[model samples]
Target: MELQQMRYVLAVAETANFTRAAERCHVVQSALSHQIKRLEHELGAELFARTSRRVRLTPAGEAFLPAARQCLEAADRAAAEAAATVGEVRGRLSVGVIPTVAAVDVPAALRDLRRRHPQVRVALRTGASDDLTAEVANGRLDVAFLGLPSSSRPTGVQSHELARDHLVAVLARDHPLADGGQLDLADLSAEPFVDFPYGSAGRAQTDHAFAHAKLTRDVAFEVTDAALMAQVIRHGLAIGFLPSAYLQRAPELRGLAAITVTNAPSRVEYVVWGSPGPSPATVAFLATIGLQPTPE
Candidate 1:
């Protein structure tokens, strides 16, 4: 089947509406539908089951989707590689980051990448460290910025350590323990906490520290967003832990006190990519962030 036909099929499968898919592909609905019908005929099976109100992928379509995506990606990468040889980088770069990424200025890096290689399209997403790392390893993301407890490192991917720092205790200005003194794990154990979800990499650092110190704490609020965590702390609903750099960047959280924790958990920030190596766009992005890939 033609690559354009595959593209049409993918668009239909993703949008699940022929008209919307046509709009996305910048083609008229009839043209897109005709191409999909041609492709289905060539493949000897219908790709979609359509009704007056809904369009759903048939079993044959489900089987064809993954290979179609791979084929498109391969074609794109080949074109990008050919361009790279002529001193041009042109491709899509999918990047992932944790909500509290602090080691690299992601927006600034994206700006530099745009200035240096305008042909490279960039897509950015924020997620938990483990999920981002998995996306990078699985080729869904070209690169990811992650943070995990000092005792852990990313697996199944190539990684570079970016920075390491202890997490500080964040408390509202009016909280009793907001006296700006260095506190240990035990000192904060009695206080309710606002923290990342229990199993997330962001929460693991503090959980491990508390376990190590033999202290039990209550997580009154479990939030996925760092800004929400800050708000929870600011309202005195619960205290939390965050990298000092993250706290410094959030002006709204300026009133919150970040206290030094004598036995605080530490985390390492890393930049990770797939094991096979980086695409040209990925390479340019790494360089934009001042990180050179390690030689294999």
Candidate 2:
């Protein structure tokens, strides 16, 4: 019933081991076990099944875990709101970002957020579009900024369109076609390709573009890091496709040429948020970063 006891229960449920959970919670193992016992005594039900080899959540534990997390999140939000009322934004907001945004925008955006709301904290996690979307849907993240399909959208989360980024071909400086102002998909059909993983949304856009031109690329490598792919392109190992933003801040891939594919598709970057809505501190941080909500 106590908040600290609830935290202990949630930590044990998450780690599935008293010893590991204690380490995570910065407490001793015996103390963590004692708190869990107290919590189980109060509820009059066993929350976990334990053995020397492993610990697994019982049915009651499984049902209680999410509710515990929600309670903690709500409590944290309430505390943040109290702080905000005193002209301070204090709390952590976890954000999932795609590579392009991390490369081009996050540094400046984070700087602005920090200066404007010194007490507010931001944690960033980066991954491919599908992975980021899944995190947002699962309540693992407060918000996500990534390039997504224009036709599809986040199902349970709210979304806002931020900007459109063009996909262009990245080629080695020494390549003959690098000097070309614009290159068609047909022009790179036979070139060795460094591309996104096949199932990724970015890959889908790349594939769709090639299909439209009736051309297939020779993919020599499939990579997820935009900057690394740019490096591979720079070394003449393969040609790659990426948002133009990749080269703007990438130090390893300087002087790489991007030829706008006349027939290529553009990707839209959106900001998606989970339920429970943004805290006042999070709202203040977002406005500071120039991503204010649209007027009704």
Candidate 3:
């Protein structure tokens, strides 16, 4: 019934261990267990099925979980809104980003936000553009940094474009075509390549480009991490395409050559938020990054 009791229950449900949950909540195990027992008694049902080894949520607990989360979220939003009325931004800002984000310096922007609004709590998550956009639309994330093919735009959310750039070919310094000259997609069609997973936005740009040119390239390796993709290209196993900014930011990848692609595929980076409108914390973050919300 009490907010603190709900916090304890949620922690226990997440960790599935009394002692660990107590540690997470900064309380002793006995105190946490006692509070949970009090809450269960008030609700007229046991929230957890306890065992010597593991703890699992009971059917009653499962039914109560979603409402509990909604209650907590509502309470937090109320407090944050009250704070914002006095020109103070104090709330939890959940942000999602793609691994290859390069339009704005995310860490620098977040650091500035922290300095400007010390009371605001910031959480960062990295994921694919598609998943990140969906999280923003679902209200699970306050903001997201995404990269999509130039032909595509994010739907169901308010977005502002950050930058657009063509991808460059990444190759080992010793590769035959690492001469720094501009090359077309057909030039690399016969060569094995390292690329993002087939269905990912990063891969789609290259795929569409090749298809438009009536060429097909063999993808010898599929990787999700940009650093790993660079390493694979550095090893001479395969060539890959990436935004030029990636090479500029990573010194370790300097040994690899980046050849300009004359007909390279291009992608656009965007900052998106839910259509419900921006929270004060989200607005502050956008300003820190030198962007304003797009009109609905």
lDDT of 1 by residue, 1-296 (tens): 89899999999889999999999999999999999999899999999999999999999999999999999999999999899999898899999999888899999999999999999998899999999988987899999999999999999899999999899999999999889488889889999999999899999999999999999999989999998998898888999999988877877678888999999989999999887868889989999988778646
Give the alpha-carbon lDDT of every model.
0.92, 0.79, 0.91
Off by over 4 Å in 1: none
Give candidate 2 misplaced runs (Cα > 4 Å).
13-20, 23-29, 48-60, 102-104, 149-155, 179-181, 231-237, 294-296
Give a tens-digit lDDT track for model 3, residues 1-296: 79989999999999999999999999999999999999999999999999899999999999999889878877888888888999999899999998888888899999999999999999999988988999999889999999999999999899989999889999999999999499989899999999989998889989999998999889999998888998898888999999887668876678898899999989999999988768888888999988777546
Candidate structures ordered by TM-score, highest first: 1, 3, 2
TM-scores, each model vs. reference: 0.97, 0.82, 0.95
Per-residue lDDT of 1-296 in model 2, one digit per residue for the tens?
Answer: 87788898888877878998999999999998998899899999988999998999999989888888888878888999888888888887888888776333765776887887777778888898788888878877877887865555666666777777677888898998998788788888989998888988877778877877787778889988887787788788999877776556667667888788888767777777765566775576567556665423
Q: Candidates 1 and 3: which is better by lDDT?
A: 1
Positional deviation of 180 in candidate 3, in angstroms? 5.7
Candidate 3: segments with Cα more than 4 A from true spot: 294-296
Superposition error at 187 for model 1 (Å) = 1.3
TM-score of 1: 0.97
Winning candidate number (TM-score) = 1
TM-score of 2: 0.82
